[model samples]
Target: MTGPAAIRAALPHRYPMLLVDRILTVSADEIRSVKAVTLNEPWYARLGEEPSKADFAYPDFLLLESWTQTAGLLATRSEEEPADGRTMLFGSMRDVEFHRRVFPGDVLEHHVRLQRAVNDTLVFEGSSRIGDEPVLTIGTVTVAFRPREQLDPEHAGRNSAPLTGSQRGEKS
Candidate 1:
């Protein structure tokens, strides 16, 4: 079991972005985590002075991100430290479905299982529930441990000028 402080140490997310509140269980193949949703969440404050019923619902994307972060922690549990300068990046997400609305005061329980891991890529199956009631399901999510240079816009695509005809070894 892990608390918020330990979860923060495992993941890079912080503040309003740090979604996982507690880790219930962890192993080589699976992990379970918790997140207590509350009206005090940063996003809820953006609903203006008078929020409506629609504004009370948590965004689906953040829900997915929270699940992803849980899976990421499971994936990296074996490593003594983050692998050099590599970081896990979401490669793909498929067959995601939301069964019911999630709101403040809901305690989200996220369960994730390792489907496969090949080289730097890891695949997982995940779901979330609110007190035994299913709230979200994801068929598969793929994440890759990639070098920061590959993902940083400042370093990527730095020198890609189009080649002239002469540069291509053809008549100009």
Candidate 2:
């Protein structure tokens, strides 16, 4: 990203957990991106036992969120020209597993593939890795796209929230 603000415009992330640093590649149904981790990260505050060694690390949940946002960039843009205006929701993440750690200074590349999308629902498979070694893989995610008015205000405050859980079940 030219700056954090640039990344914010590419997707609908605010404040903390907007992990993507810049977008490397994008298509109608997929996106590839990068995130540069640094010692100044919030998550590393507690994880780093040695304050002297500000060797920051990426958290699993946030990495997942990053991947979700990457897929979101694609999912949202896939229909950028559509007559209907539906917002992107993460839906349900299944089989999300972290294999390795992305430390400070490591630029992990995220590759996301769109599997399917029908009506307001979409599914995708994504993976994050450093070079040839994989760091995280999300097997499947099923989510629905609804108009912005269908969501609760509280769900926007936290990356994960109770209201989002209930709304996911209700299908907008």
Candidate 3:
């Protein structure tokens, strides 16, 4: 079992973006994780005053992202730590489906299986549920190990010092 701290160490995500709340089980072939949804989520705030019915529903894209992040952890568990200045990124996803709406009180249970791993790319198949009700399904998902420098040209090379928000042209 992996708690929030361990999950934080294993994943680069944080705060409102860090979707997975806990990892119940993980092995070479499969993984199970959880995400506790609540009204405190940033998306809920984005709905503004007197939100509509659609605003109460969790966004489908974020549901997919949460599942993909869970798969990413499973995919990288067996591999050596990524080399300096490198990170794993979502490559692609296919046949993703949403079976039902997920609400603020729902606890998303994610189940992911290792479909295959070839070189730097890993493939997975997974689904999510809230209790006995199915919420999402993914036929196949792939993630790639990539160099930060290549992914962001502004980052310079492997040995380059990290840049601050202002240096990157963002408000501090």
Q: What is the TM-score of each candidate against the true structure?
A: 0.83, 0.75, 0.84
Residue-level lDDT of model 3, residues 1-172, one tens digit each, is 8998988888889987999999999998899999988989988877877887777999998898799889877967856665358778787789988999888999999999988878878888989999988899899988888887865766775666676687678985
Q: How many residue pairs clash in each candidate?
A: 0, 0, 0
Instruction: Name the candidate that leads on lDDT.
Output: 1
**Alpha-carbon shift of residue 105 in model 3 (angstroms):** 0.6
Better of 1 and 2 by lDDT: 1
List of clashing residue pairs for candidate 3? none
- lDDT rank order: 1, 3, 2
Give the range where candidate 3 is weakest over 10 consecutive residues by summed lDDT.
75-84
Model 3, residue 155: distance off in Å is 4.5
Query: Which 10 consecutive residues of model 1 have the lowest summed lDDT?
Result: 151-160
| CA displacement after TM-score superposition, residue 27 of candidate 3 (Å) | 0.2
